[model samples]
Target: MGPGRIAGVVTVPELAEGDRLTVDGVDLRVRVSARRRRFALTIEPDATVTLHVPDGRPAPDAEEFVRAHRTWLVTKRAIRERTRPVNPAKRLVEGEVFRYLGRTYRLTVADDVPSAGRVRLVAGRLVMSRRAAADPARGREALVDWYSRVGYAWSVGRLQPWAARMSAAEPALEVRDLGGRWGTYEPGTGDRGVGLMCLGWPLFQLPMRLVDYVIAHELAHVRIPGHRGDFWRLLRRALPEYVACRAELDELGRRLWMGEIWWGG
Candidate 1:
């Protein structure tokens, strides 16, 4: 994905309609899709500038139209710069800040023999205890292990009963690692029965609502097995606010999985 940058000031009087003007900032991609008669600004995880016009209107009139929305352009550019991604590597050290449950938590590292792995509180604060870090691979293992266990436990506790309530085609439920997709549902195949594969560590950053949306979406597939109206209806029934949850997840996905992880040399 390209970085978003502030486009100083764009004014074109000849633009009519059905035209798009995008100002890419260092952190966001802002675009305006315009038409002859009207326009609206789209801003959230992805910034979009849009306009509408009558069917017969010329498609090139957007340049002139955008001249009217210049105030919005400047405001949005400032917002994009503020929302730019933070370096995750810097977040690994003590005194750094990270967000969890809509709150900021400072990192605190210490040594605890019994409950000795890295853990986070409901407030999203990190608690790291003293442990062996013989090599880089060990550090990576420690990190992945902590993230996976927390993500898995949190997911299973929430999903088990929801899965039961949603699907009657199975007796037992299972969880595994999923790649490329957030989660998947498979009907009984053999002695294997029914199962779910949730991708690694995503639950850490994704809100509970989004995780539930994914679980319901994939579980709905157990019955529908495809993207059809019925599947959507089921998903909607399970998560009425699925749309917002989906948007939030998409935003988190872009941030979390975008960086590199170095375990060791």
Candidate 2:
């Protein structure tokens, strides 16, 4: 038995990925990044606090950073608590409404159909096989898959135009689940010559304008990595009304469904 041991089990303290620390009653998930030049903090959509530390930074320095920013963190958390969205869980039932690119379509469980094909939009209805509808997980997967496919198709056409307008290269694009991010732009590495942009499937549920805003926002990152003054200037050059679009996105994005399924008892 030792001071830092329990029942003959020795506990080793080290800084590594997925490390967690509690400072001033706030839980922080520690993440070390080589690309980061300084310490930064981000509040996730689920209200989880993440502290981004630069490679080689010590744990004590990270704790000091959190302590210095404690006031800001508290204010932000309070604001988030008041503004957090109450998005309802969706059920896999008939006539349940779903939105895509600002258009509403009701769900149709096709039992009479011979095969349970991939979810599709036929005759203005989102058709899902009865087999999938019977299972909540399958139904949710089918719907998200549909969104990813359709969103990718729609974004392909929109990408080039925005790229041209912003004087940025048209990088590789993907549509999928980007947890806590509507869009992300990764600069090209030595192995990959061109950058990559990934948009969350849930973003497709927003209006076309908002989708365009996200596209343009990521494209701006192609030129400017961070959201500094120069980045906003470049974005404004392409979209004069970008300020309004950003504000609207913040307000509307809170209400989007994040794949929560309602299991009817």
Top candidate, metric lDDT: 2
Q: List the residue pairs that clash in candidate 2.
A: none
Q: Which ten residues in a row have the lowest lDDT in candidate 1?
A: 27-36
Cα TM-score per model: 0.54, 0.89
Q: Stretches of candidate 2 above 4 Å error? A: 1-15, 112-117
Give the distance in Å from residue 155's predicted Cα in candidate 1 to where it truly belongs: 2.1
How much does candidate 2 score in TM-score? Answer: 0.89
lDDT of 1 by residue, 46-145 (tens): 3443444334333244344455666777697567556644424433445645443234566565555356554545345566544523233443445556
RMSD of each: 12.4, 4.1
Q: lDDT (0-100) at residue 25 of candidate 1?
A: 28
